[model samples]
Target: MGLCLLISCGESGKRTSVDPGTDTQDISSEESKPVNTPGKKTIVFFGNSLTAGMGLEPEESFPARVQEKIDSLDMDYKVVNAGISGETTAGGESRISWLMRDRVDIFVLELGANDGLRGIPLSETRENLQAIIDTVKNHYPDVKIVLAGMQIPPNMGPEYTAEFREIFPDLARANQAYLIPFLLEDVAGIPELNQADGIHPTVEGQRKVAQNVWEILKPIL
Candidate 1:
């Protein structure tokens, strides 16, 4: 796959072929505008900047796009963008409780990309992700989960990259959750789909991402 350049970019500071570091600020509090409707269920997109729509407007993000699709179909569900730029699995695990306060019917997990970029231990990443999943399950036993898979360049060695890619599906299977083979799919590594940073997706790219998620998410709804 040409997804070697599909590494999630949000963490600020140094950059690399694998790490297109941008912003690592946590904005989930402001971005995750959860609307509670009496009868409507909720779909919470929990992840990093790619989920946050870093350089783009909040509505331009894939979660918002998913919301648009749901509304167009008159689905009885609202989307909550709980994405924070530059969030690692550890960070997400730490704050998972805060997000759990709201009712979550469908939970989409999109972390671990930054951990891959930072060369965090694969075991550690897996553990944190599992913990996050466990937290969500503890809060809402009936909530459905959709895990977003990610890929990184071979900068961290082919073994590391390959294993990093396997974490998502393995976890999804173990937890009996749904999986999006690769979150970026057609949008990654394509210069036209990304912004000037050549990392984060542009508006059109976000739309493609939404389609990718929809393919799997649609069946669940």
Candidate 2:
């Protein structure tokens, strides 16, 4: 499938696109300002199905909620959901260059859950994620990164589960990026928050997930 690019305009009237090879350094430097330009901050949400807002309307996804929040605050920021269902860390790495070509102020990196679910090797997942971080850093050293963590189901066994859970924090520290303890902190495993498939979150669940992400994100934004 062709890569998808989502762009939203904030009050500042600046338009952001998802084009790989864009000058991220310029974007990152601009984001560090005490106050954002009239409408310039562009936050990209990158991940798999979870970020894609599976089972929910596009506008109802967590990224959309974040956009709404920014709008409500009248912040000069736009939130773009770049999530793809069933995406693995490897897949994300392959697309990172192109996906981030546009000017991106902040990146919410969420991946690896599908890798764990598919029983992919942890080492491979780590390498893929690390590569993504390295590339982003090389392109935009000052860009703020928020690494979202995920936990594999207990059925994955203790050894694999523990290792998978550690990847996010480890990568965040290694990359000097911010960390969100758990992407699904209050939503995962909660029957009321999940859909019939039990894997994806329902609308209510996404709200909580958005809140979980927002908690860490607000401080940086």
Task: Give stretches of model 2 more than 4 Å off.
Answer: 1-38
* Predictions: Cα RMSD each: 3.9, 9.4
lDDT computed for candidate 1? 0.84
Residue pairs whose backbone atoms clash in candidate 2: 12-39, 19-101, 19-102, 20-101, 21-101, 22-101
lDDT of each: 0.84, 0.73
lDDT of 2 by residue, 1-221 (tens): 11111111111111132233232323322322223344587788887667777667777788889888888887878787877555677767877876556677898899887678767899999999999888877787888999998887756688998998899999999988999998887676677777776667778988998999889998898
Find the candidate with the highest TM-score and give its number: 1
Candidate 2: residue 215 Cα off by (Å): 0.2
Instruction: Encode model 1's per-residue lDDT on 69-150: one tens digit a residue.
Output: 9999999998988877667888778788778877899999999988998899999999999999999999999999999999
Error of 2 at 70 (Å): 1.1
